[model samples]
Target: MNIVYWALVFFGTFFFMEFMAWFTHKYIMHGFLWHLHRDHHNKDHDSWFERNDAFFIFYAIVSIVCFYLWSYEDVWFCLPIGLGILAYGIAYFVVHDIFIHQRFKMFRNANNWYARGIRRAHKIHHKHLGKEDGENFGMLIVPFKYFQK
Candidate 1:
């Protein structure tokens, strides 16, 4: 395929994966998998890379499988899609854990609108503690209603 074709495929797959992530985090992780993800919200001096980090481990395995499929087909198109996943992973690590939570105190201040918005949205997600969970599901963008506080 041409470069433009590859770019389109990569970005389309990337956005789909991101939407999947949001849905997974909201429903799967926050719902049935709460036992595993609870560690993220629980106030404790656990490692900066809390148990919730296991989610990335699963993601890595899926990426490897996707890469293998693409390689077998000689498509080479999925390489950029994998790169997009890596980019989103890095952004999630930096923005969600490191900067927003101040897990490592990496940033003195998160002054950006996106940062503040997501942080506030995540805060709301934690407000109910358990029952009324699954709100503010977006990792990068807030859906306005989440910040109604």
Candidate 2:
């Protein structure tokens, strides 16, 4: 409720959502759901929003459920958690898909370390298949171990 409380809630929810995303991406997306995710790995020179974007439909359902739970419990604090998840998804779409993959030319002129690093990490992830593709699983936040190479 207060400004400080809201700030804490926002930051806490952001990190928690990031961790949850990392876990889901590392396991669920790469594991059983690989059937659907495999389309992402296959190289196809086409549109910016590829078949892999379908994963966002599942994410939207999860976001709706989270918001519903937060509303039902009158836990306004958790609303920020839902927002954090949405924010992370948007960031991933923009950074990973659009910028790194050159899905869109919006950032073509922008040269920066963050963009370069993300592009490099994602390239490594796409270089191999199966367990060898484990590197750079995190979208926005790169784990230190992924860069050891």
Candidate 3:
């Protein structure tokens, strides 16, 4: 039962992060914190890193704190929670940064319907250079219209 509970917690947190990502991207990132996120929509610098990367650092710290609580405070559920957040962060990095933006120079040849759809949705999102009029904010679960041929 403990294993099942932990698994549920892990998977639940994993899925929830998608909503969190969408919310943060739409509200926080595109909202008052547009200064931190503007570089992502419109690249004006030559550096490899953007100010938008600060968002990842914030989530990473949260995951680290969860792991610390699980280890030291004996909060067993924090282990799964931390793992879930970390997993989502990794998926976001791979799908958004590496695959979509080609930041790592890999995953370039993956040209399937899903891949194309993801890129198309993201392209639409990036079409808006400013903080307004943006669409397709979520990373994993894009809209079905983007999946059309």
Candidate 4:
């Protein structure tokens, strides 16, 4: 029963991260913290990294704290939650940074419906360099309109 419970908790956190990513992208990245995220859209930096990378560091710290709690403080559920958040972070890195932004060399040829849709939606979002005009913030749950050929 513990396995099942932990499994459910793990997947629940994984799925919930989509909503969290969207909300954070819409509000925080586009809000007062836009200075941190602005370089991501504006691409003004000479280096490959942007100030926006701090958000990933923030979430990584949170996941690390969850892992610490699960390991040391007897908070068993935190293990699955931490793993789930790590999974989502990896997915976001793969999809958003690697695939769409082509930060790395892999996944460039992923032309499937889902991959294409995600790329399309991200393109639309990046079309607006400014904070206010972007759309399609979520990486996994892109709008259906992007699915069309």
Best by TM-score: 3
lDDT of 1 by residue, 1-149 (tens): 48888788777776776787788787777888877787777746546667777898887877777687678876577677776676677777787888877767787575666666677777777776663444746577668764433
lDDT of 3 by residue, 1-149 (tens): 99999999999999999999999999999999999999999888999999999999999999999999999999999999999999999999999999999999999999899999999999989999998899845799888888866
lDDT of each: 0.72, 0.71, 0.95, 0.91
For residues 35-131, what per-residue lDDT tens digits would candidate 2 score against the true structure? 6666678746465555667778877777777788788977776677677667777887787777877667778766566666666787888886664
Best by lDDT: 3
How high is each candidate's TM-score?
Answer: 0.82, 0.78, 0.98, 0.96
Q: How many residue pairs clash per model?
A: 0, 0, 0, 0
lDDT preference between candidates 3 and 4, better one: 3
Report the candidate with higher lDDT, 2 versus 4: 4
Candidate 2: regions farther than 4 A off:
43-49, 69-73, 130-132, 143-149
Q: List the residue pairs that clash in candidate 1.
A: none
Off by over 4 Å in 1: 145-149
Whichever of 1 and 3 has more TM-score, that candidate is 3
Model 3 bad stretches (over 4 Å): none
